[model samples]
Structures are given as C-alpha cells and as structure tokens.
Target: MEEIDKTFREAVADGRIHGAVLIAKDLTGKVDFSRSYGVRSLREEDPEKRPPMVADTPMRVASCSKFLTSIMVLKCVEMGLANLNGGLEKLLPEVAGLKVLTGFDDAGNPIEREPKSPVLLNSGLCYTLTFPLLQQYRKWQGLEIEQGYDNLDQNFKYPLLFDPGTKWAYGPSLDWCSRVIKRASGLSAEEFLQEHIVEPLGIDSDNMTFELQKHPNMQARRGDMTFRGGHTFTAESSSPGTGVLQYRDEEYWHEDIEPHGGQGIYTSPESYAKVLWSILSNDGKLLKPETRELLFKRALTLEAEKSFDEYCEQFKAFVPGVPVPAEIKHSHSLGGMLTLEDCDGDRWRQEGNLSWSGLPNIMWNIDKRAGMCTIWAFHMKPWGDPICIELGTKFEKAAFMMLKQ
Candidate 1:
C-alpha cells in the first residue's frame, strides 16, 4: 500500500496527472486499501476552493460503465426479468433487425444482407457504431449522438461487422442491454440501478448515477478531465506527455442524454470498488452464486475467440496496458475479457479473472483466485495514458505483493 501511495505521489509531483483514486480489497476483507492523491483541479486559483482528490470524487467512468451495466443485467436474470442467452429481437428489435455488411458495391455504395445467425445476448459484434458504413450513415443522416442510446437508430440502420455470435467487436451492445433491462423491468436504467444495485450494496445513491448534474453533491465534487498535449497513440513517436495540460469537456456528454449502459455513468472509485468486491467475493448481496458465476464464464465461440485474439494483438500497439495479454490464451466473459490461465507480469493475474478499462485511463481488475479486486481512477484523455498505465501497473503489483503477505 505504501508503494502505491509513493507511485501516485510521485506521479502527481511530476505533473503526469491532476488527481487519482486507488482502491483494493480482498475477499476476507483483511486487506483493504483505499486512498486518493493530488488536487481535483489545477485551474482553481483559490487554494481553499481547490479540493484535494478523495475517494468519493465523481468521475465519468466511460467504458467502465459496461462492467456495471453487466451487473444490472445479471440481476435482471436473477429476477427472471431477462435471459442472458436468448436472442435480443424481442427486447430490442432495432438491434435484431440489423443486417451484416458484406462489402461495397459499384459507385462505392455499401452492400449488406441478412444476418446468417441470430444476435444473442452476449454477441459483442451484433451492432457496432465504429463500422465505416455506420459512420458514413451517421454523417449522412446528420445524427447527433450525445448518449450511447441516442446512437441506437443509426446502429440499427448500419450493417453488422459479422454474423452475430460469430465474432467479437466492442460497441454499444451493452448500451442496448440497458434498453433490454428497461423494457423487461419497466424502469429507466438509472432507476433500476438505484433500486437494485446501489441500494442493496449500501452505496450512497448520489455517489453512483447516470445523471451527475442532478446530484449536486456529487457534481460539486466532480474532478476535471485533462489531456496531455501532443501525446496520442497514433503519433509517430509518442512521449508520455508534453507536460502541457489541456482541458477537455468536464461534462463530456449532454446532461439530457439517456442513461447509457455502455458509458456515461458518473461514480466514485470508493463506490465502484464495493461493486467489484461483491462480484469478486461472491457475497450473494448483489447476485446469487450461480448467477454471479456468469461474469467469469467464457461466452465466446471458437471463431469469435480467434477474432478477439487478433484484435488484442493489434490493440496492444495503441495502449501501454493490455487487458488481455496477446500471447496468453483468453476469451470474453459475460462481463469482460477472461484470461484462460494465470499470467505473470508486473503482477500475477489468475486464470478466469475478469478485467477491463474506461476510456479516460480508468482500469479495474477482479481476481477471484487471489480473492481481491482493484480499481485505478483517473480523468485523462486517450484511454491508455502512459503515465496512468505505469502507475496503475505499479499499484496492481504492490497489491498482489501485499496479498502474498
């Protein structure tokens, strides 16, 4: 824990990040480490007004929302309100009706045909917004997507990259899952989370929500989002950063946007840590034992696994921290990526453990073997900021070492 503190302190002192929160806890609750470092905003001129970072500082957790959404969807399964394996046609006709893109026709028009298979609940490639056709169509339609769900219609209009369940492609499929939860349970995504997940876990309602603006307490404590100038993965020679901090939209999306299952949730690291610990410990507080097992189970087909592997290999060049080691055997879990066996690196990650990252350099690890989970929270541009990754790696290594003791 002291090592983690030193790592973050040095990072702050060197101007690598403005503020960050780190939390790690084990199944037995014997090892609980939670701390925050640096200031929330460097721009605040008044010393008293400028707040020091804390465990409850709100952050727009980006794709980390996927992991949280997965939990809510699993709860729906426990209540018999949703089925994890069933086709999504009934729940979300827009997603089900999407065609598969074959290629382009003459005159550069896109060619699409009916899908060869049904889009299952776990099919990550069913409907993606990243496809060229989708992007073209979005531009053509003048689509203004401020929220994850706002892209639903455009996603429906676009073609699927491949037949559903045949390959893995990260997209708004989980956001569509939010729609499924809404239709089946008769509640907005935000309300469902508040009533079931947040309340039962004893997390402060204000600390977790899709609409941060409405929660004045949490919004007031919200940290500023910053980015390193001239530092991007695509650059020919990427440096950690130029040391000049440029600010991004602190509130990334419009406040009026609907709650997206894939992204846009504002939550505190301390609050999120509780959710991960519940899954890691299988505490039966948020989900039943059999139901919680889904998070660790491999949900990818052989063909899909191959595509996922290739994607990971190419993705490694873009980010310093690789969630899935390209050389290691891996597969997609119901919630996130699952390593097929133990991996030795800065730290030892166990087989079948689930993990993922947020867009703004946030990362989480849920290790069942070590009976522990860890989350590193930072608000920065470009998903894999080198400074955040380096310190995050060190923090993880320290946590595992502490577990050994």
Candidate 2:
C-alpha cells in the first residue's frame, strides 16, 4: 500500500492533482488504510505544510453531492412519501407548461414537441437538466432564476426535449430531485441531508456544502480543457459536458441559493471514504440491505430509441461529453451513474457493478463480484496534467489488487 501510495503521488506530483486522498475498505466496513497526498491547497495558505488530507478538511467534491440527494430521495420513497411512476405534470404542476425542441424538421425548420410524457418524480431522481427546455420554460412564464436550485428558475423554467422517462440528460437534475425531496419529505435538500443522511451516518459536516471560505491552495479554479480535437471546454459556473474546471463565480459563491446538488458540496478524502465504507457495508446503522440494493440498482437506463437525443443533444448542449456506449451498462441510481462493467477510461461500464464520480474528480466504485468498494478524490482538473485520473486508476486498481492477494 505504501508503494502504491508513493507511486500515486509521483504520478500526479507535477501539480496536476494539487492534492488527493484515498480510502480502502473491506466488505466488512473495516478501513484497511487511509492517506493524503500533496499540500492542503496548491496556494498553500499555511506557511506550514497541509494537514494530512484526513477526515476533517473540507474538500470541494463537485457533483458528489448528488449521491447525498439520492439518498434523501430514496429515503422518501422508502417511506412512501413519493411515487416513482407518476409524471411531473402530476407531481410538479409548474412544469406542465414545458415544450420540447427536437432539432429541426426536414426543411431545416425548428420542430416543437408537446412532450410525450410529463417529468416524473422518479425521473427527477436521475439528473437530466437540459438547455433548450431550460430556456423555453423561462420564456413561457417570464421566469428568472435565483440560484442553481429549487422550483424557480431563470434557467430551468424551459421545456424538455422529451418528457421525463424518454430522454436522458446529465445535469443539475439534482436540482429537480432537490425539489422532489422537499415535496416528498416536507424537508429542503440541505435539511433532509443533514437530518437523514449526514447526521445519522456520522458524516463530517464541512464536506457537504458549496461556497466554503476561500482557502488559497484548495480553492477550486476554472481551467481550459482542450479535448481530443482542439475542442476547448471552458466555464466558471457549469459546463454542459465537462464539470467544474473551477467553481468560484461571484454569483455562485455569494447567493443564498438552494443547494447546488450537482456541484456544490465539499469533502476530504477521509470523510468521503467513510461514506463509501457506510454504503459498502450498509452499516446496519444507516440503510438496510433492501434500501441499499435499491440504491445500487438502475433507476434509469438510456432508452435505445433516443440515446443520442437524450445524452448528446439536450444534456451536452454546452460541455459536450460523449455518450456512454450501449454496451456500457450505465444506470441512474440515486448515487449518480452506476457502472455495470469495468470502465477503464474509454469503457467505464462494469457488469453488475454500480458506481459513479463526483464533479472535477472524485470516484466511488462498488464491485458486486468483490462485494467491496473504494473511494478517491482530488480538487479540480485543467491543471495541464491528468494526474488525478491517472493516480485514481492506479490506486483503485491497487486497492482491488490487494484484496485478491
């Protein structure tokens, strides 16, 4: 493990990973080991070195916040607070007015759709925020958004490409789920998380919110991501395809916005590792196996007829992330993307394996075969290096490797 850790640090030492933390847990919830690498912040605010990336230091964990929202939503479902099959028109009458923008008709004219199905409570459980619908909704009602959250929007008030179940778009759908969580449980996203997920699980509080006080080294920074073919993805707030290169827009930091369930939370390697430990074991203290099993199962699978329309078209409107292959078993669990096969970079689908990552770069993997899991994290990317991904793959493989040994 020491050798693995040393190699991981070396792989990212070129300042690509700024800092990182890793946690390995066996099936029984026993943490085999924990460690932190690099300084607390690249800015290194302290004259002294970073405190070990332990359970305490809050890390900006991007979209990892979705998993917590997933849990809260699931809890509401388990308690029979919300029905999984009802459409959005029923659950959220406000969205009854959304329209669909299918590219164009045969004559290169715009095609407007009346939506085959309304968004559903379960659909919101999956993050499928889209752009055309966002804009259209705002126009329909003269809407204006305050935060990247809750029932109101200058951004999300538009129509959707397809009604809820038909399309699959990746986004702040957690924002929608946040609304469902509030409606179903009579609790806000933050409150539901604190009461049900965080407090009960004994999770550290700092890593759960967005907009922490700026720390020199650890603060997230925006960066330019030059993809495969000279395509550069850039944004300070939210990229359509790629995630937070850095997340410090004044509006983002200052507003008393609703929880940015997609990318607002913070975490340290140690604290998130504990979450992995809890989920992997079901803790007997948190969720029963039945509830956890539901969490692992696919809440949503990409529909064969409209895969591209859902992922590449509507969802990737701006950032432009590639569509995961059909062979790649990607499911929408409350915890975000679930893997059914081993996704070693280009291919991330692992058969019967359920897992996902937080924004920038934080991953949680559960191998059903191994009946074990691991957790890992780093601040943000676009550091002119791919060390975080590189190191994560290495350490994750190493952790799994040791189990066989």
Candidate 3:
C-alpha cells in the first residue's frame, strides 16, 4: 500500500483534496488496513494547530447514507417491519398519491396525470425537488423544510419523472422508505437504527449520528467541507476548473424531523466499516442470510436494468475518477449498484460486487465473492473530483491485489 499512501499524501500536498479516510477489510481477516491523511480542517494555517483527520472524523457522507439506510430498511423487512414488494399506499400516503409531472401548459402550469402503476416500496432514487410547481407549492405553503422525513409530504409534491416500475431516475424514494421504517416499527427512524444497527455493531454515538449539532464531540471533530472552484453551492467561482479546493460554509447534516433515510447521516469511515463488514462477512448480527443476499443480488427488471444502464453511462461523465471497466454491466441491488460481471478484468471487484458513492467524492464497495469491503472518503466536491478518483482507483486496486496475495 506504499503507492496508495504516497499518492494520497501527494494529492494533499498539492491542494487537490483536504483530507481523506480509507479502510479496507476482508472476511478472512488476513488483510486489514486503514489510513487517514491530511488535516480535518484547513482553517488553521499552522499544521500543529489543525486537527488531524482520523478514521473516526465525523463526515456528512451525503448519498453514501443511502447504503446504510437501505440496509436498515431491509433489516426492517426481515423483522416483518417492512415489505419489499408491498405498495406504498399505507406506508406513505403522500408518495402513493404523487402524480406524474409530464410537462407544462400554455399558462405554465405543471401537467399531471395518474400513474398507470402503483408506487411500490422499492421505487427509490436520490431526488431533489427542483420542479417549478413543487418549488411554488413549498414557497406558497411557507415551508421552511430542510433535509428530513418531516419534509417528505411537502417535498414529494412534485410529479414523478416517470411511472414507478417503468424506468429509473434518482430521487427521494429512499427518504420515503425511511418513513416506512418508522411507521412499521412504531419508532423514529433514528431510534430504530440505534437499537438495531448501531448498538449491535458496537459503534459509539459520537462516531455516528444523524444529529451532528447535538453531539459536541462529533461536531468538534467534524471535517471541513471543500468544493471545486466552480462547484460550490452558494456561488460559482470566477475561476472554475482551476482544481482549487474552496471551503464551503454549509452544513449538509440535519437535526429536524425523522432522520432522512436517503442522505442524512453523519458518520466515520471506521464506524461505517462495521456496518459494511457485517454484510460482507455474512454475520447474522445485522441481517438474516436471505436478507443479506438481497444486497449482492440483482433486483432490477429488464426494462429497469436498461434504464439503469443508460443512467450509468451518463453518470460516467460526472464520475471521471472511477476505474470501472466499460464492459462491466450494472444492475440495482436492494442496497446499491451491483455488477453483473467482474470489474476491471478481475483485477478488482468480482462479479456480483455492490458499490456506490456520495456527493462529496465518497466511494464504497462490498464484494461478497471476494469476501471484502472498502470505503474511501474525501469530504470535497464536484462529486467526481479527479484527485479523489485517482486515489480511490489506486486504493481499490491495491486492496484487491492484497486479497489476491
């Protein structure tokens, strides 16, 4: 792993990234390695004064939260708290009633129509409410919503991009699923996750939480949020694509409503590793064998897989850093992206491996065939930052090579 360390250090020295935490473990327990590089916050110029980024430094993992949330939802399914194939009519009435947003009219009104199919429990995608009608509705209602389950009824007022089960589009479907978990278990999403997932895995609350503001220890250890020059959410920099890492004064983690099941998580690579490890090792402490199989198996229909393939091809333009081979086919698992073929010509992940990423250039993999799982976290943006890609590719290849040895 010397090359991996050297590449990461070089990137930090060159201002390509702020900091990162990488952890790779295998079921055989032969190759266990982890490393933390660079300072957590660049606010302090003096190296001695800056807090060092560690494996447990709390990070707003963004969409990587979905992987954990998906597992929790499945756990609910195993415990009879959720039904994977059930319709959303009872579990989520608002989502169930959502209409299709076909287009607009002469007066600029959103065109709507009832969906031909019912929205099932599995019709989830990472979506944001940017539609004109939905925005107007929220503004008219004076909703001061942040990212949480309380905002779901208001947020999903927008029309579905396509009928559920017809095609795939990334939206707030998982966020709604979180609501289902809550209603079925008769507990808040956070409470259920803590009792079932967190406590069983032996992770400390300080290391993983939905409310970063409440945990001062995690708040203090939180890393700075950095973004590419043209990519900061607040404003576009005059000089974009300069590869400059600018600090953003924004908080993606939230404390309001039930914890977002899709993307509201504050956690560390080490803490999350336990969750991934539990799945990778097939340990019943987290899920049943049948339920765990759901994470690695493909769950998409032929039509959905075709749509998912097109989306992946388009996603490549955004994800320039990953070394996924072009020939590898992708299908959605119950948890995340599952490969139908060996990745990187068998040099990295084998067939049936599951993988996904977050907005801040975080990537994770769970390879049951290889008995290994890995997470590489860099809290910086423009989702597919090249520096992150380079480091992640190196780190993933190195981990796979270690397993081969």
Q: Which scores higher on TM-score, 2 or 3?
A: 3
All models: lDDT?
Answer: 0.75, 0.55, 0.75
Q: For residues 321-390, could you state the per-residue lDDT of candidate 2 as single tens digits?
A: 1223334445566565555556554223245565666544567766665656777766554321234556
lDDT of 2 at 94: 64
TM-score-best of 1 and 3 = 1
lDDT of 3 by residue, 190-242 (tens): 87778878899999988877767778888788888877775733123344335
Candidate 1 per-residue lDDT, tens place, 70-147, comes to: 988998999998887777778988777777777666766667788888876677353332355556545545654222
Highest TM-score scorer: 1
TM-score ranking, high to low: 1, 3, 2
Off by over 4 Å in 1: 45-49, 124-134, 140-151, 154-157, 230-240, 250-254, 317-324, 345-347
